[model samples]
Target: MAETILVTGATGTVGSELVRALINRGVNTRAAVHSIIKGDRLRHFNPEVQLVEVDYHRPASLPLAFTGVDRVFLLTPFSDQQLIINQQLVDAAKAAGVQQVVRLSAAGADMEPGIQLGRWHRQMEQYLEQSGLSHVILRPTSFMQNFVNYQGQSIREQGAIYLPLGEGRMSYIDAFDIAEVAAAILTDDVAKHHGQAYTLTGPQAVNHTEIAGIIGQATGRPVQYVDVPETAARQAMQGAPQWMVDSMMELNALGKAGHLAGTTPAVEQLTGRPPRSFQEFAQEHRHELMPA
Candidate 1:
């Protein structure tokens, strides 16, 4: 019998792509989503793929999802309660005797102890290390999908990309590459990637100005990068929790200081292919960037 792999956050950017990659390779995959309603995206892969509603907050929902599962791709939503939710998955995975866990972490999670996001990921990494299950920690840099998720409408309507990252170079990675790497590790021998942490990145680091220029070239329209002041950025996020807003500002500050500009060969090392550049990402998603 083939080994079963459970993928948490199956409906998300990386998770959805990871599931597709695993299925493409003929892996017996189980996609754990929060609701059956959200499983619509994965419906095309029915029969070949199993969709299970696994709620991290509800401990009872996990064990059934883990049944017969040999490996797990653990991805927790971003929130103040991340630690609790991650712990719940770890404990359940331990109880289920899952052979391995591939966790989606963030860049600088181990190096920068001050950033709240990194700190949370680091905490989860430490817990997984002690969980006694073989694991792979993927620390990918900021995703290129952020443009489509948070600023696509602005880019289409106003031809502007606004952020608090002031002239700082960032190695924004494509989530597709991250998902490919995750699929590779999960499908390969556990011993080959176990107890390892991979800092995944794009081919090069580019500032917001360069990013805007790339989009402009791809869409044949001039797109501008608006560098907002920290105060203004904070005000824009008025209704969000104070801690979350402060974290975003601090992360942007770190980027502006050029701390997030590093690139790595991890993506190529795992997938045996060069990571996609921002220009390539823009061209591929041109329809989303171009105005209707």
Candidate 2:
């Protein structure tokens, strides 16, 4: 029998890509999505995919999603209740006899006195470690897709990228690359990756100014990076909740401090190929980042 795998956050960025990768490899894939409707994209990719509705608020749905799963790809969304949801999933996976799990974490999750985001991920990592089930943790830096997802509009309209990151560089990885690494480990020998944590990143570190230049070349436009004041950044996010605003500012501080600027070869070591570069990502997403 082929190995059966269940993916949480199946409709998300990395989760969606992982589902596609697993299907391509002919692995039996069950995608745990927030709604059956959201699984349409997965079905569009491969009609054979098994879709299960999983809502952490609805605790009973947890075990059913894990039933008969050989391995799991766990991704809890970044929210106030992230820890609680991950704990619930771990307990459910344990009860359902899951053989292993590949968890999505952040870079710097293990750092001493890190930011709230790192602290949150570290807490979950610890819980999974103590759970006794075989596990592989993937701690990836910021995604290159953030340009299209978060800053696309400004790049398109104003021909400028605005952030408080200053001259700090970050080795942002493509979510697709992260998914590829996850698929490789999930489908390969479990023993090799068991109890291991990998920090995934792109091949090089780059600052926002360099990122702006790349985007300009990719989109055939003139784009510049604007280093705004922290107060101005805070004001830009005024409509969001106070906690979320503070959280973003904390990450901004880390970026400005060059704390997020680091490169790793784990992606190449695990997948037998180098991670995607920001230039490639910008080119691929050129249409999305082009002028509106």
Candidate 3:
């Protein structure tokens, strides 16, 4: 019998790509999405991919999704409630007798207890370890997809990338590569990766100025990276909850301190290939980054 894998956050950036990768490998895949309507994006894989509704807050809804699932790919959206939500899923997975769990976490998750996101992920990591289910914790560096998700409008309208990162260099990995790594671990022999924590990073580290140059070359436009003071960034993000603003500022402070810089071999070690460079990512998504 083939292993049946359940993927939570199945319509998201890494989850969506992981679903495709699993399907391509001819694995038994179930996509646990929040809503069947929004999951239509994954219809292309229908018949081959099973779609199930999952509500993290409501623990009662998770067991049915985990039925007969051999392993799980867990991802909870970033928020104040992430710890509670993921704990709910972990409890559900344990109850379902799932064999393994691969969690998508962030860099510094194990090291920086003071960072809000890192703290939350570490808490979940600890819980999963104690849950008695075999687990793989993937702590990937900054995502290259931030261009599209967070800074696309600024780049398109002003030809600039604005952040409070100062001159901090980050080895940002592509979301697709993170998915690839997850797929590899999920489909391969589970014993090799169980109880392991891997930090994923791109092949090279680059600062915002270098990224701006790469974007300019890719889109054939003059793009600039403007470093704003944390205070100015906080003012610009006015009206967002104070916690969110503080979290963003803390992350920037970490970046500016060179804490987020450096490459890791975990991606290559796991996938047997080097992670994608930011230049390649920018080039591939140039049309999207280019002014509309």
Candidate 4:
């Protein structure tokens, strides 16, 4: 019997890329998405990807999504709904006779509620362990693509970046690399990785000022870093919805305490290559980092 793997958050930045890698490998892929529109968009890679709409708030819809799937790629949306969503998936996965789950979790997920997202992911990781399912937790640090976020404003209008991070070093991993690792775990019988947790990070820990200098060199503009109070930074994002506002603030607080500096050999161990550097990420998406 051919085993099937259902990937949640298939429309998201990481899941979307994993879906492609699975298709290229010819894995029996199941895309569990929040919207049919998103699933349909992903069908471009291969019509073999079975698309199913799954809202974890409604767990009844999940058993059907999990039917005939041997493994699952569980990615809880990083929002208010993460805990309930993870709980629902765990319950449904147990009920559906699923074999394994590769959870997309946050870095520094210790038992003591670490931070906002970190806390919830730790809770979910515990729940999955208690559920007795074969599981592998992939905890990745900050994402390099987030720098693309500041590109528009910094390159286009701001001509500089204002963040609370100051010179705090961070090991920002690439989303695509994270997704590839997820796909590898799902398709392999490498039992060594099961019941284990992996932490992924970029090749180097660099500061925001260094990032500014890198962008300045890449874009032919003098980009400077302006550090502000965390309160002021949160206030600057007042237009962001409550969940995002709270999440970013909690993350910055974690950064100030020196959490994001953690690095690992897990990326190369799994993918057989060193994780992408900030410079490589910046160069590949320079257009996104530069103002139009």
Question: Which of 1 and 4 is the better model by TM-score?
Answer: 1
Which 10 consecutive positions of candidate 3 have the poorest summed lDDT?
39-48
Off by over 4 Å in 4: 111-113, 149-151, 239-244
- TM-score of the candidate numbered 1? 0.98
Deviation in Å, model 3, residue 248 alpha carbon:
1.5
For model 2, the superposed segments whose C-alpha errors exceed 4 Å read none
lDDT of 4 by residue, 240-274 (tens): 88888988888887776666897999999998888
TM-score of 4: 0.92
| Regions of candidate 3 where Cα sits further than 4 Å from its true position | 45-47
List the candidates' TM-scores in order.
Answer: 0.98, 0.98, 0.97, 0.92
Order of models, best lDDT first: 2, 1, 3, 4
Q: Write the per-residue lDDT of candidate 2 for residues 9-77, one digit (tens) a residue.
A: 999889999999999999999999988986878997799999999988998999789989999999998
Model 1, span 68-178: residue lDDT tens: 999999999988888999999999999999999999999999984569888889999999999999999999999999998898999999999999999999999999999
CA lDDT, every model vs. true structure: 0.92, 0.93, 0.90, 0.84
